[model samples]
Target chain A: MSTKTILCIEDDRFIGEMYIRSLKKAGYEIDWVVDGNDGLVAARNKSYDVILLDIMLPERHGTEILEALRGGKEDLIPKSYVIVLTNFQQDDQSRIAMEKYADAYLIKAEITPKKLISIIEKIQD
Target chain B: MEIKKGPQIASQFWPEFIKQKIVLIIVSQIIISIAVGCLIILSGFLAIGSIGFWLILGGFFVINLATELLIVISATRPTKDLLAAIINVSGEKSTLTPPNPNTKEYEKTGFRDALQKIYELSSVKDKQKTDESEKKDDNQELSIIEALNTTICGFITLDKNRQVIYANKPAPIHTNVDGIKIIDLLFNGNDTLDSWLDSCEEHSVHDEHVWTRIPDRLPNEEGRRFFDVIASYQKGSTAETVLTLIDRTKSYIVDEENLDFISFAAHELRGPITVIRGYLDVLGDELADVLVDDQSELFHRLVVSSNRLSGYIDNILNTSRYDRRHLKMNLAEDKISTIYDTISDDMKLRAGAQNRILNVDLPTKLPTVAADRASIGQVFGNLIDNAIKYSRDGGSVNVTAKQNGNFVDVSVTDNGIGMPESVVSQLFQKFYRSHRSRESVAGTGIGLYISKAIVESNGGTISVRSEDGKGSVFTVSLPIYSTVADKLLASNNSNVGLISEGNGWIKNHSMYRS
Candidate 1:
């Protein structure tokens, strides 16, 4: 089987580092971006199996990037699974992510990093 | 300040109104007199011979014309005076004496007298109508004033001269100082009422606190009483200033206690939950390869329990938010299908864990709803969770969603031990749980309350239909989002046929099946 690559877009330093380390230990390649704009650029630049996008970000909102990725005219990246992982508990935020064609919505505080990886593995299968 | 107005006349009916009728009468009389003169001349010509007969006819014609002229001349002045008198009676003009009845004018005053009578009758009718309307207005004002005086909120009104116009009973109750100048009440005798009054004219003031030190407010009552004062200058013919005062002592105490408890609980619970989840993640990561089969299962169970505990904490926090009326919705357009898809797996897992069956019947396409996604998810999650909890004995929980008129209605049906009528009525109340459910299931009893608040704040309704020994169906109806054109078309349904069609759709859609 080919190696799987994951892109994590998170604003919080500790959460991003934790997920990256955990996923790397799980034997998958991981690339992490800290801001919304950089996440958008990286997602547009490279193809990955899954993208973990956070809602609250610095330069741009994670949902806006997702909207652009799915509906933008520019053909930047191939079709990939988009997972929204954020601390925001608002219904509108979750709905917006899903409406923009998100594959999964996970609250980071509710589930363990390893559990999240298992869910991602299931989705990949 | 109330302005005094004198009794007003309906000036539309004036001297000109009487003059027009009198002119008609005089013109008709002159026409009749001319016809009489012509008849007299014709009879004389028929009865006598040529030259002498013509002379007598002319004499009779002259006599008739003279009499008519005398009558017209005498009637004109008296009729004008009588019209003026009638108008005065109607309050349109100043009082005037009616023309003397013993004079020549009285002989021609019949038409004037009859007109005066008609004017008097109409004036009385007009007066009745005015009095009735005024009485209604006065009653309304009096009732409103009484209500204000009896309420707990204080009301004080000032005239443009800055003098007190009115003060309700609660004004003194809240402020502890009445009959004092408003400026002094606000400034505490610092003499800045003029500038404050000037400033109020430009803009309204809001939420200003006033602390009055009343040494002898009561026996041994020396502390200052706090009041929330809101003032505004009303601009009109008579400019006035209105001030409202509210006592905030008791409510402030209650708010402080509630806030303290919520903050303490949130901090204490959230900190530990985060730490425990973090440690559990570390353990799962560190022991993933070394754990035995049963050990792995145990770990998974622990994770599930932890997740459940965290959700309870979230619900508790949300309940407090609802208590404070602080659940701000982030509204957006989204499909109800997305919510169904997101929570379907969770619901299935939850129901299966309790030895219950979960059935989901979601439409392939539904109208987009104006909603907050996370809030809607929480609402559905709470309902589905409740179903699983209440129907844990291998019962089936059916979930369905479909388009109903302008809404997307979703229902969670559970064939569990249903609640009695009394218990069901209070199901959505805060911290209320049925006795049977309380004994059988462990719950905080605030989940349904928070769910209801979340749903209602997002412009939806949550209702339930159930019977004793039968299952319960909890339904939530959310309004569908419409495009600009669709909204315009919907609003333009002014035709009776279209309106009835809409009503029929509503009735058909609102009907529920057991």
Candidate 2:
């Protein structure tokens, strides 16, 4: 249908709005979730080209949710793609998140919404 | 010979100890010689009568008495000669035996016995001990002579005329001069030495060794060495000055290292922390709607950590400002009630996440305090931040501000775990944190220190009182108005933090609400 379907899961209002605006302009079909439980439900019900997630959340943390989705425990959603968005730049956190099948790690300060959108699009291609 | 007058003064004048044997020896020798002299006279007397022999014996006896008196005088002559020689050589005087009354126990012992006695008085090995002692005294005298004649540490001694009398070893090395006045030694280049010496000479007495370290830096050198010098005057003697030098390069090096560590640490922490907090702000926008479903304890922890990290980064930033002494502040006239109001409303939402309560005790007729409003706001904001971080779940914080005699006193009382006694004393010390805080809270311990500085700079005083397991009260008093800076110090407390609770605002906030 669309160029690609991207599921965006994040907890911060400012950055989420920025991502939503930029991804929409990037010409991608997107479904958004602010809560971790909602994220699980959204992914389970629909198929997406990629998922952009935040590490710290009010529901389940981005890392924990990513772990469950990629652990192959419930296979609630088709394992299409997953990317982590966080402010922390520690190497250990990156390694652990990647080990759990997070497709990309981008520092929020180093990347803006448009920059992140292009990178995700490139990965999809 | 008789005993000397040293141990017994009165016995020196008494000639009762001449001894009969020495008297007899002198008498016999005199009789043998004088009898021969009288022999010719006796022969003439014998031709006339027996009176010749009697006259000869009498003449011999008289000669022996004269000879004994001369021998006694000659025996004491060496001591009198030495005393006169020393008086002529040194040109100073002491309580010495005058030649008019001198005595000695010449028959008491030999030179070996005398040397053995000297060795007993000395604390040294017996072998050449006399020589060793003499050598040591000679060395001491040589050192003192060198110190007096040279410019060791620029030292010199002068008489009442201010003429050069003595100098030290370092004087020449330091000043490259010899034989200068005491005043010249202190102020060889500066004119102040001239006036200071004039004043001391005119007014001061009993020249009690006045010592001061004179610091001088070499041309083009960044540091200076200190020279310690002292001067003292005996009652009847000329005043003397002694000096010593000390180098402080190592101490300066240590200070530089401390500054380096603080600056390095400050920059290292803030770079990554600013990025982390920025991302957290991004997450708040994205997770607003979805966060309501799984409001687990884990989410609360994540929120608290982010806030704590943000506070830590701010602490680092504050430290950098403090180091430069160029810290920024916004001074304004603000009412105490207003500051409390802003904190209550804004801070409540923050406290709500952790389920804590803030009780405000503000007087309606509050006094207006003149201070840096933003810095003051930050001060209490940090206090409230610490209150929430340190308090257990469901604890309460009480804030009170009252007017008392041209000042407004504010107190923040928390029902949190109290700090250690040692920590309380240094609560306002920069970078000093409690062991409990290290484990329980994520903070830059500089909050209280900064608060104290902020309060004091605005003509106010801040203090803390805490008891372990009981609670803590931080009190701040500020002048009514008309001051510039609010804090006394710009604190760098980067290692301070607070632990997080399971149910926290980081998870349940309007920013994160869908």
Candidate 3:
């Protein structure tokens, strides 16, 4: 049997609730954090399959959270891969995220709900 | 200065001679007749003469001469009364547009009342009416020509020889020229524009002709803050040159203020869009895959709203440039073909969404016109966008280019809802739109006016023609830059960061997919 935990961090309550309902429906145990500070602490304390990062977050900001996970700060337990969520276009961020070891960034509008499932499942594999 | 005692200029002395000739000729004839009568009487004395006979003959001659002089007096009366009658009649016949006639409404009260109103207007100088009042519901049009003579933007038209063919009242005050050589309005001896004038005259007879333009900062006085004087070919069956003076200083200041706001807003907005994209990537494809539920609908709504919001923001930013009316052209040597291709590609998405077709027929090899690249690009974009917006569903828009020696002509043709002759008449008016806009099209009515202003600023011209039901075509001509910009371009020849590089930080956006 395969078992994995996913940390979904988001600021928009509507999309945050969608993530909790959808990922759990897909049968992965999910840890949901609303703010950037909670997301930072949860990543450090828990072991998770993957980290779902929302670039726009209310607390502690998305980039600072990425830098912290990249070991910008002292320590974190789970060495989970990071997948970015963004609406802005331009290759620079994708290139830089890879330089810092981020797995991928999905352009927000370009992806549909069905497509979003495929990308998440592949990353889980 | 010696006053020459010889015959003066013909015009001046001809009147005096005419006056005196009638008096001199009449008086002399009377004397000569009187003398002849005396001679006849005295000579006849040898036959049947009495002293009374000579007196009666002389008196009869005097009376005849007196009658001739009185007839001449009536003939010599000036035509001033005739001119007064004509002015009074024409003023009564033709409608006095707006503010001029606003007071005339009192005339329906009675003839006595109308005369009283006329007396009132006569007492108040025309200057008392505010500019706002002049703009009353195109309800009426007063002779803007009459307004020009006094309020300041003097209107003047000159012929090929720099002769003052027409001058409105305020010409001397605005131009600071005291009825001197008409060419003096355009050039001074210190400025040698003989060669430049040659370039301008070539356009005079052609479909588009223009003179060398020297836009200098207008001497700043209180009301005369800054003015732009444009001399362009007013195309007609027989083409005439038209010069328009626009006071841009107030509009210029407003533009500067708007530009500042845009830069500030743009800078702040970019940071948030970058952060939003970062979160989207982290959520993975799972976020979009949820659309089967109501949650997905929310996602769709979010995307649509943001896209529309951003589009409006971009329009405001673009128009802000022309607002200040302060356009500093960074002139460069550029190929028209490449420029056309770039604009076509950039606007392809807008066309695709509307299912509109854009056909560009530019020559493989093109002559270069010296111009501001970004400004010209925006001009093309606005024109094409207008075409697409007004076009029938799935209609085609065509662009064609050709060079005639010193200028490049670009025409954009659209098989769209054509403009009626009435609307077409004011095609380039600010905030002017046809009745069709109220029905289907959307616009601010400022696009063409701004486009015309930009093309003219760069020593170019823009024109249009449209049939009521068929379609419309807009043609623009820009002078081909021969040398200066090309030389500068040769030295700074790197294509790296030549265009807008967007704001600084890119690594800040990583982990973005889709």
User: Considering every candidate listed, which one attains the maximal TM-score?
Assistant: 1
Using DockQ as the measure, which candidate wins?
1
**Cα lDDT tens digits for candidate 3, B1-514:** 9776744433334356557767786778878886776676577653336657756765777787778777766554322222223334334432222222224433453433444454456445444555446677243545554566667664557566555566665453234367553433323112233444466566554433232322232222223333445555543423255555554556554544554576458534644543343244345355666556666545544443343334333344434434433334445566777666645544665666567888888896668887666567667877887888888989999988999767898899999888888888677754568777867777766577667766776667888898877888988887887834555467544321222111111122223332
Worst 10 residues of 3 chain B by lDDT: B497-506
Tens-digit per-residue lDDT, A75-96, candidate 1: 3455567777655545343464
Scoring each candidate complex against the real one, what DockQ results?
Answer: 0.10, 0.02, 0.03
For model 1, residues B26-59, the per-residue Cα lDDT tens digits are: 5765676556557766766444446755565566
lDDT over C-alpha atoms for residue B138 of model 1: 99
lDDT against the true structure, per candidate, is 0.65, 0.58, 0.58
Off by over 4 Å in 1: A1-24, A28-107, A115-125, B1-76, B83-147, B153-264, B275-301, B319-338, B363-372, B420-445, B456-460, B478-514
Candidate 2 per-residue lDDT over residues B1-514, each given as its tens digit? 9765532433332333435445666767776766665675666645424676667666767776787668867775554444433443333444543332113432343333433343343334444767888999999999877755553345555566656565554442333266333332322222234444566666665544332323343312354344444545433354532233333344444533454465557445544543444454455556666777556344555555555554444454444444334344434466887766634544665677778888877886876886555457657778888777788899998889888787888888898898778777767655668877788677656777666656655557777888888788887787776343233223312101211111000111222223
- Computed on C-alpha atoms, the DockQ of candidate 2 is 0.02
lDDT of 1: 0.65
Candidate 2 chain B least-lDDT 10 residues: B498-507
